[model samples]
Target: MTRRVLLALLLLGLAAGLVGAAAWAYEAWRDRVLEEGDRRGEARVQARWDEDRARAQEAALDKARQDAAETLRRLNQQQENERAQQALLAQLARDRDAARAAADGLRLRAAAYLDAAGCGHLAGDSALGCVREAAAEIGIALSRSAQIAQRVAADADEARSRGLRCEADYDALTLRLSML
Candidate 1:
């Protein structure tokens, strides 16, 4: 071949190699830019997910705190009710004791009056003995009646306290439901 023709062929081959290298470099730069954009998008998605998770956890914690508070309130109310019941029972016992003492005193007074009126001197007279026996029987009946009445009062008080507690519990449940 001629030298000029050989040199021209060599120059053409060098120009083609330069073009191929430039295209490869551009493709590499484009791939790097795309990869960086993908990385940035992933980071944004992860950040948003983390924020959503944090908010959900905060909401759960708030709900738990509310539930705990409600439970504590219920427990405190129950304890107060128990204390009130104890006080009521103590008062009832005091009243029962007082009533018993009063009844005993009344019985003693009646006996004294009977003795003063000559009812105790009934050894010979049948009518006087019958009257004394009737009076004693009446006194025994009255004592029994008083004891029964006291028992009934105590039972009624207990039933009333139970009903009040049940009502309170129902109200608490209703209020909680309404909040939900």
Candidate 2:
């Protein structure tokens, strides 16, 4: 009877040890699984964050490129406008010079006509008629000179106005660019 009891007790101790070892192995496995799951979740979150940051950076770069393009376009347009204004100013100068030359030519012609009328070598109605004709031509030349002078003045005024307008436009564009 003593030998039977000893054998039964040894068998029970072996069974308990195996159950305890199994329980410990199961706990270790559960901890490993949960840790792996946490690592995978952290990796997914990091990937999403990197993607979001890249997208935001790309968007900012795209906007910068667009803004640069717009600035370039405006600068080009401003240059063209300045060139056109300069051309207009140059043409106005030429026109004013031409009108002045015409007026001067008319004045010279009027003086020549008056000098021709000072012919004291001729006498009688024929000489008087020649003087009268010379005076009439001088009057016409003087009137033409006055008209040309008026035209020159008008052109000068127009050029001044255009120059002022160009200056104002440039100033406004500069101010707007500074704000940007």
Candidate 3:
């Protein structure tokens, strides 16, 4: 009976040792599995961070491009406005010169009329008719000057209102030439 009991004790010890070895192996494998899972999770997080960073960079670049385009457009607008202003100023100067010339011509014409009207007692009807015609011519010339001046003033007002710097030179030129 002692021998039988010793054999049974040895068998039980061997079984326990086997179970402990198996349990140790299972724990090692479980720890490795958990570590691998953690590594995978960290890699997934890093990928998401990289993607978000790329998206943010893209958004910033897009905003910068838009800002640059807007700036360029504003600069172009300024240049265009400056050119238009110069054009208008040139037109105004020409109009003023022409207006002066027209006035001078009118003055010379009046002098000629005066010289002709100075001949008294040459035929009362002819003398009176000459004076009347001269007066009508002078009136027409004066009226034309006033009309041209008014139109120029109106054009200036319109330019100011519309923030434009372009004038119609032909219209003013026509009025001045008519007086001449």
Candidate with maximal TM-score: 1
How much is 107 displaced in model 1, in angstroms?
2.4
4-105: candidate 2 lDDT, tens digit per residue: 888888888889999999999999999999999999999999999999999999999999998888678667767776776777767776777787777777
Candidate 1 structure quality by residue, lDDT tens digits, 66-155 = 989888877777777677767877887788788888888888888888888778865458877887888798789878988897888778
lDDT string, candidate 3, 71-150, tens digits: 66556656676676677667766776687677767766765666576623343587676876666677677867767875
TM-score of 3: 0.62
Measured with C-alpha atoms, the lDDT of residue 47 in candidate 3 is 99
TM-score of each: 0.84, 0.61, 0.62
Cα lDDT listed for each candidate: 0.83, 0.76, 0.71
Off by more than 4 A, model 1: 1-8, 121-123, 172-180
What's the number of clashes in each of the models?
A: 0, 0, 0
Error of 3 at 12 (Å): 1.9
lDDT of 1 at 90: 81
RMSD, candidate 3, Å: 10.8
Q: What is the lDDT of residue 94 in candidate 2?
A: 79
